[model samples]
Target: MAKHIIAVGAIYIDTILTLPHFPAEDEKLRASKYVRRRGGNCGNAFEVLQQLVEDDIKLHLISVFPNRASADYAFIRDSFKVSVDLSLSIHRDNSQVASSCYVFKSQETDSRTIVNYTELKDMQCHEFIDAVCKLSPAQDAFEGWFHFEGRTPDTLVECVKELRLIPQYSGFKISVELENPSRVGLELVAAEADAVFFSRAWAEARGFKSAVECLKQNMAATKEHALLCCTWGAAGASAVQKDGGEGIWCSVPAWKPELENQSVVDTVGAGDTFIAGMLCGHCCQTSCWSLEQKLKYATDLAGRKVYEEGFAELS
Candidate 1:
């Protein structure tokens, strides 16, 4: 049977400005370059996954967007280079598209500062359930993978609970990303997920010094069969799989660019790229791969992303 991977999150149109340096208070500066692209946690991940997966595995995006007739909606819809099932997406009438503005300072370690604006309402638990119901059918027997961005923790918890109640979704594997540390009740959502992806910023915010330290302390909150991964920027990444009341840990070093003295280009969607790589390794592989392989594949893909401006040529 074929497999299905669905990602649920907000979609944004990103406006990126590359400047020589960040401006000080009341200072004016000219940007060196301007670029616009489709961006979001789920949107970026699906982009990379589209290139990594074969034709057998289908990709789907569950997001909120403006009216179908709007130009913003058209741009987003036409941006995907590969087939991504957006039938499950929700459209809001008389609403503006969610957008983000990023300022990349070339003089300061290739850092970026972002400001976001959105007038569209977030998808509620009922809406999520409705989309899943429309996608699931009695006669279809494809394996399902549901990934949540963990943006709205309360709604996510309810959605997960409702999914568990549906008999048709019993065989589905669910994953959740815990990217924000300040989001209260995210741990509850993580506890319900079969796989959880943690960010380096989240670990430091929670007072954990290392990726392994964070995973080890949080292992008790997950299911016995749960898999946990944490990505540390320059330090590489690590994973801990819970099995038989024990945690199996694996770590891999960060991948550096092959070109000598090549500065990092862009770090905008690196985390999303890493998530897509891990998902690709798990979903597209014919046989089960070791933890080391999974980490390396994801880390290397993300490393490559940093050398380019966008996700176009990462695969």
Candidate 2:
């Protein structure tokens, strides 16, 4: 039987403008260049995962969008280079798609400032459960994996709980990313996941100084067999897995460009790319790799992503 991976989150139309520096208050500046693409935490991950996965494993996305007639919806649907199943997505009538505007400073360190606008309603727990049931009608159909972008905490927690009650989805593995620190109730979602990805900002906001410390202290909140991973930007990434009643921790240094003077060109979607790499290693790869190998693969892939503008040819 073929396998399926479903990613749940919002989709956005991203307008990126490159400039030498941010403009002063009330000052006008001309952008050096601009690019537009389909972007969102889940959208970006699906793009990279489609490139990494094998032919047999299928990819699906469960997101809420405007009506099919909207140009924004059409652009997002036609943007993917690889085939991704968007049939599971929900459409809203008379609604507009979410959008984000980014001002990227092309200088040392390459800083980015983003502003987002959205009026669409979030996906409710019932909607998520309905999509899952449609995808998995039979108990022995195929192995399934569900990855979530941690938004709408109340509905997300309920969604996971509801999924657990379904007999056909008992074998499915769940992973979630906690990237935004301001989003409350994410710990509840993390507790239900088989794997949890933590961002540097999320850790620091919770008073954890290092990635290792963040994983070690939070291990109690998760399941005994859960895998906890944290990414620390330039400090690299770390992971801790429970083994025979003990937690084993592994850390890897940040990957650098092979060619000298190859600095970071774009930082957008790097974290999402890392999530794709880890999922690829655990879900698509045939060999059983160690925790260290998984971290290294994800870290290297995220590092390579910074050298390019968009998520093309990353694999």
Candidate 3:
């Protein structure tokens, strides 16, 4: 049986500029490298998982893109066709694809600054449910998993409710990436997710001292069986499983740069890649591995992602 996975979000056209150092506010600077590619939390994760797996699983993506007639949409379609199953995406006429410009400074501590613009509308709950319902006979019969970027919480809740109502989808696992803690309605969405992922920054901004603390505070709002995980860039990753009985907290050290086989160049999409690696582990070894071992595998895989330039390089 082939495992089916779907990632839902908006895809972006990314313009990455690498510089030796960040320029002063009033000064001009030259970029040492420039590249453009398709990126988004879901898209990046899907691409990484696609490259990591062989032919056993089917990777699917449900994203919004400009109409096929648009040059930007054509470019993205052509570029990612070999990497994911985008047949489930939503396209709108006269729509412009979301775009982001990132400036990466290579001096001192490597950091990235991003500015994004979007004209695309958010994905609606019914539209997503409808797309999944319309899957072909073959795809419809397979057991699957869903991963969504946390956006529009109410819509996600409604979508999850609809999915659960389907008799054949009872075994489906739903994971959500809490991309931004500041984003409204996180509590509502987290309560419904089978698994929830967060970032250290998102946790800190909410006045929690650590990811475990943040998750524990919010775990009160989640279902009894919900599991929460958080990723700290250099510090490490942590996970707590709340099974309605007892909660177990576990943490794993992040992969250090000194242990990598390749040279570090870009840190872009590393976190997304981490989500991919974790999801890969979840899909492959759901019952066998301990949470600590899974975290180590994910962190190590993400450590290698930093050595590359873009998500596509994983192939």
The global C-alpha lDDT for each of the candidates, from Candidate 1 onward, is: 0.88, 0.88, 0.78
Full candidate order by TM-score, most accurate first:
1, 2, 3
**TM match of model 2 to true structure:** 0.96
TM-score of each: 0.96, 0.96, 0.91
Per-residue lDDT of model 3, residues 179-241, tens digit only? 676688866777888898887777888887876777778888877778788887777788888
Q: CA lDDT of 38 in candidate 3?
A: 81
Clashing pairs in 2: none
Which model is ahead, 2 or 3, in terms of TM-score?
2
Writing each residue's lDDT as its tens digit, candidate 2 over 261-301 gives 88788889999999999988888763788779988999999
RMSD of 2: 1.5
User: Which stretches of model 3 miss by more than 4 angstroms?
Assistant: 81-83, 96-98, 104-109, 136-140, 258-264, 312-315
- List clash counts for every candidate, in order: 0, 0, 0
Candidate 1 TM-score, C-alpha based:
0.96
Model 1 ranges off by over 4 Å: none
Total residue pair clashes for candidate 3 = 0
Candidate 2 global lDDT: 0.88
Pitting candidate 1 against candidate 3, the one with the higher lDDT is 1
